[model samples]
Target: MRLTELPRTTSFRLALMFLALFGTCSLLLFAFVYWQTVGYMRRDQDEFLQRQLTFYSTLSPADRVQRLREHPRNDPGTRRPSGEFAANGQWLVGNLSVLPAELRQAHQPVDFVLPSAGAPVPFRGYATQLPDGHWLAVSQNVHEPREFEALLLRAMLSAGLLTLLFGLAGAVALGASSMRRIDAITLAIRRIVNGALTERLPVQGGSDDLNRLTREVNGMLDDLERLVHEVKGVCDGIAHDLRTPLTRVLGGLERAQRRASTVEEFRDAAARATEEIAALLKTFNALLRISELEAGARRAGFSDVALAQVLADVVDLYQPLAEEKNLTLQLSGTASPTDITLWGDASLLFDACANLIDNAIKFVPAGGHIEVRLDAEHRAISVTDNGPGIPASERKAVLNRFHRNEPSRSTPGNGLGLSLVAVIAHLHDMKIDITDAAPGCRVSLSWSAR
Candidate 1:
């Protein structure tokens, strides 16, 4: 299968799975709680009746039976007893059917299962047998239970079921809403990859992860836009700069071949063509090098570097070149020696700094001044240069590969210097800015100081 056709990952699916698992666990927990609560409540009621039966056994058996029979009657002193009062606010009591021989032989409070009788409604009962062959029993009717407890259990189970249903629906709804936003952002990112650089993911501004992801994705698009525009400009420059010289060399060679008056002339034309091709090859090689650097494929080779030492060496190497161009180059600024180190590809940083110095020498006129300054700020090493300052409007524009100012349009250099600098800057999380100075331009390179 094509890479793009592979199943896409979704957070909503994972969220839904978790929600389902949570709901299952919650249902099991509710089931356990219901059974446990009902069991405990039943146990407490039965234990209370046992205690009352034991106390009632203290009375004469005849008196106990008389009380049970009269307890449910419509007497003037009719009152509800504590523990096991039925609906209509009365105790359930009556004589049971003939006891089995086993029950009769083992004389104690025994739970009996019997058929229903008139109002007594046979149930599991706890009883006590007196030594005198009389008996007293506390009957727990299965048909009629405590009204409030039964109602409460019913209500709780109903509420739990409703809550489970609503909770599942709410979870699904929330997952759907999040998934919609994510799908929208994914579509926008797909558009960007399809050459729509202006496409940006929407942000909800709630400081959520997706919002942060949107901003980060947009930032990536911006960087891609800059890189793409730079590549296009570089292609344009290769066509403009190389084509003219190559066309000239080709034409000269063709003319010399047509005449053939002297061998030296032919050789000169061929040599010039060879030189033009070599120059073209050099530009191509430089382009490939910059591309490789920008791709960060060689990051494994990076190492810790002394920022101050790198700056000092770069300034020294370019000083003579600056003198030849009739411009003064100087270095200023002091920072702690320990603070001047950075984690980076040292050779690349050196090349980047040298390129800045060369550009300064190339743009500044005779007697113009340039200074290379370095300092540690906010965990970064900064290098600033002074020369014919870049125009404010075109400061960003000049960073594009092959972009040159009107005045420097005729200057003899392909515009890859700053472009290479830009690649290194990005690799090291560095920032480079060209600003207009009082008299000339200033360039600054800032990288995270290790």
Candidate 2:
């Protein structure tokens, strides 16, 4: 960021705007003070003149003349002076030499300048016509008030200049700070674009608006990085998982073409190939279903669903398989089936619960007890199996697509069952918890009732 670009920044521009507003207000305040001060000084001077005029008016003519003649001697400074003048404009007695032509009205205050030594001195005064047709004027020299006005103006100007300097400095500082943060963010974004997936925006640790925005962007970057890694993992999983089935299908077909002379033998080979193809198709379909669920494509199909009913249905669907494996499958809950309900897609919820029960049947040993438990108050359903439970470390990994536990490698599955369940739970705004069932594993899905 260059100095030339500083003014273009929003922070700098706003600072300048506020500074201008403050300067304007200060100027108005100074003007008002100046006006009031000058008016008060002028009024005070005029009042003094009026008081002098009244004192002279109460005196006899002889005494008035004596006081007027003695005024310059009694007040050697001559800051305030009185004078008597004839109607013809001739100065009679006092410090003043002649009647001011500016004082045309009687008993009215006026401002005029008189030659004092070699300089012209400003005065405020009032003149009154006596019965003898002579003018008596009382005045005060206003050099101090005028000097005070000039001093006040200079002080105001100095203060204004200082304020402007400081304000400009502050604005520049603020603009520079903003520019630095923006530059850091831009650099981070460029790094991310250049494939530094872990790059994040800088945080100043302040709770200011800019810092808050940076934190949010960094959080988004964190999510983006996680998604990128997940996508890479998914692609790898697809390639690895599909290669075996596709190879088996191709190898079986080639074997049947080259060596299977008898129809029965050919039919056997064809059947094996068909099975591999079917398994491939099932895996692909499961992947698609998980994708659809993750994208919330089935949200429009959501309706109020009973948790206990879904658990019972899942247990019923998987009970025969559990029995075939010499396992016991039971549906149990603390509340009535009708009472534990939530808003969700019924089919998706059923499929999710079925997946949990199916996984339990697959993993649990012979004569293992599997229970589908529902909690009405928490709007939750849990499937627990008394078999070798999933390892604590692999619990979260099993939720990812195509993730299979080491011990379950020989099991008949594409490894998408729990992933599908996870997607379904997420789509319904439910939380899935995999916990220890004491003797085995417990997988629970819970939601907040709206």
- Which candidate number maximizes TM-score? 2
Runs in model 1 deviating more than 4 A are 1-20, 28-44, 60-125, 138-145, 182-195, 203-220, 255-275, 297-304, 307-309, 335-339, 376-386
Residue lDDT tens for model 1, 223-269: 88877787788778878877877888788878888986887877887
Residues 1-450 of candidate 2 have per-residue lDDT tens digits of: 888989889999999999999999988998898889889988888888889999998899899989998999987888888898998879998987768887746448888898868789988888888888988888888888888989988998899899999999999999999998888899989999999988889899769998999888889988787767767767877777789888888888898899999999999998998888898899999988887777788888778886667777777788788889899998888846677678888888889888898898888889899988887767788888888898899998888877788543788888889999988888988899998988899999888868
lDDT of all predictions = 0.68, 0.86
User: In candidate 2, residue 361 scores what lDDT?
Assistant: 83
Regions more than 4 Å wrong, model 2 = 54-63, 66-77, 88-90, 93-101, 104-122, 334-337, 437-439
Q: How many clashes in each structure?
A: 6, 0
Write down the TM-score of every candidate: 0.75, 0.87
